[model samples]
Target: MENERAVEPAGIRERLSGNEAVAIAIKQIHPDVFPAFPITPSTEIPQYFSSYVANGEVQTEFVPVESEHSAMSAAVGAQSAGARTMTATSSCGLALMWEELYIAASNRLPITLALVNRALSGPININCDHSDSMGARDAGWIQIYSENNQEAYDNFIQAVRIGEHKDVQLPVMVCQDGFITSHAVENIKLIEDSLVKDFVGEYTPENYLLNAKRPMSTGAYDVTSYYMEHKRQQAQAMKNAKRVALEVAKDFEKISGRSYGLFEEYKLDDADYAIVIINSAAGTAKDAIDKMRAEGKKVGLLKIRLFRPFPAEEIREALKNVKVLAVMDRCEGFNAYGGPLGAEVKGALYSLDNGPKVVNYIYGLGGRDVRVENVEEVFNELEKIDNSGELGEEYRYLSVRD
Candidate 1:
């Protein structure tokens, strides 16, 4: 099945917001269960999915719960019982599901979550940022991010196959920036229903609680004698996910005519300066790269698509030659060192004695606007660092008022 191909199918073109695209994808997959609780931005996903259930478009059991914690709890139970289950959430909603997040992964239940990325609250913000998802980076789930509505839809569709693969039975988070991509309308090409169904074939778990012949126990308390081994197995599953994700993307391209990779490198092959970023802001940075290129500056961008099982070796190879690099993080890690992304990139390149001089910039917190100009300024700073041969402040903030 590694080299499997499906006849390229004609796409149904439509203009839709990110939330609508994800919901429509869910309708097409038509999972056995969807345990839902509405949270702003992500609410539309379940809202649209519920309408599909109401109209007989899908036969999925739509369980509307009172809170996000219960939403995830129900998802874990349903998935363990041999049902294909999924749910949607944002910021605090995800925070509420904290415990179940680990439970689903530890139980090896491949539940999909449509996460509209929002800033975690202290001041109670309802805007775009990576804090929520970043905070759960170690929760033993696979994470894939999107730059726009099209990627959001495509990623969600592919997530099912990635998570449910026998070698990688872990939950998946299909994430998109809140309101930025989630609310903004854009033209997209959707796969035909038949093709989507054919691609995401079926969910047949080998060992499930529902199978009478094969009795099983899940979420049992593990003492010190066996707890570490269970954690180790989860880590190994995450490692397998990296290979599984790329294989799934290869097959997806056969049906959709769109190609995907662990990360996208824009003009980085012969570039001197580059920026590493994720999600919707990657679109803005592309524009900035173009502007800088026209002025005879060699600038490029690496946009991450598969965030979890963080493609460290691949990322190191991609940016090994660049003279200076900036890792743009939308969340504040407050580690006094740098954001999560910064820490990951630096750690990946630590073994390379001549690795690019890297710096981390925290930006776009609480839905603050990220424009081409701001991205260009970051590139300009990279150029200065390259020329000066001195990297100033390894950790910094972008567009924050002093």
Candidate 2:
């Protein structure tokens, strides 16, 4: 299934932090509007982007709002007026935009949000965790998680196309682990400005408030009878996004020679034990899996990328063969059972009568470290469960103090 067209040469290599990489991508796209309120970790994104605006590098209208709510509100207004809009936020900042998040998605606005994942408040910590985006998982926006700076940049660029596609006109959240990827600098390859411009193309929305000839109303109060229908349509659009995301990734790979999929399967084909995880910890898990593989332990991993759509069927097929499984969550769902990701992965595998024995482990809350040794310990437990044929506690905590 190869295209005849020659792949474009790789883009220039650069050293950048996740925030800086994302800022560069936004500058290259030259989006119409960016209404943002600064938050820790994610604050650097708008900081860098605003500098571009001031330097005349990009003509994007950079609005410094008073709060995240105003940021999202302005984003909705700008997007409704037929502009390709975007914004950035983290943790409580994202929590503040909760209401407007649904508004933008329900209105079918393709607004891109560069989300730096952070732990939500109470104990008041600033670090890498999926609590921010995980809390907003059901908000109807398409969610894409990145593992590192390179992925953050690449995912943000692809988000524009995925969200704006006709069948999937929904807002998008391009997420990366706060501080872990956001503040950490790494070598990344960037697409050329002309290539990115041509790839994203023009933002010609079909029906907008600004269109004089096609006058229409948006965000009107929906009666109960129509509200359910509107919600149903939004759900269908989310379903459509799974296909659109893959399509966009194919095009992206053609141009950049970097392929992406719903999830990354690392040595999972014939493993006896596997771990299902997300975001930055996946890198650590991979190293652990490699070391275990050399020792002839049948261990592998499934790293989720597209979280909102959940890709349930695909995930089930990916992990169906494993005898024991560990699902890691960086946030506390506080359910006393496990976390959000554990819930989703378990639900995905529910129908399999002889599916892998699944164990949900809550780990790395408030930016606690996840080392290769820690991941290997998880695999060691899975091996024990496999050999003993006795399932222990289904819900557990990993690398947490007694």
Candidate 2: list runs displaced more than 4 Å.
1-8
Clashes of each: 0, 0
lDDT of 1 by residue, 1-402 (tens): 498765566799999999999999999999999999999879999999999999999999999999999999999999999999999999999999999998998999999999999999989999999999999999999999999999999999999999999999999999999999999999999999999999999899999998999998988889999999989899999999999999999999998999999999998998999999999999999999888899999999999999898999999999999999999999999989889999999998988879999999999999999999999999889999999999999999999999
Stretches > 4 Å off in candidate 1: 1-9
The TM-score measured for candidate 2 stands at: 0.98
Choose the strongest candidate by lDDT.
1
lDDT by residue for model 2 (1-402), tens: 977987567788999999999999999999999999999989999999999999999889999989999999999999999999999999999999999999998999999999999999979999988899999999999999999999999999999999999999999999999989999999989988998999999999999999999999999999998999999999999999999999999999876889999999999998999999999999999999999999999899999999989999999999889999999999889888889999999999999989989889999999999999999999999989988998889999988779
Task: State the C-alpha lDDT per candidate.
Answer: 0.95, 0.94
Error of 1 at 162 (Å): 0.5
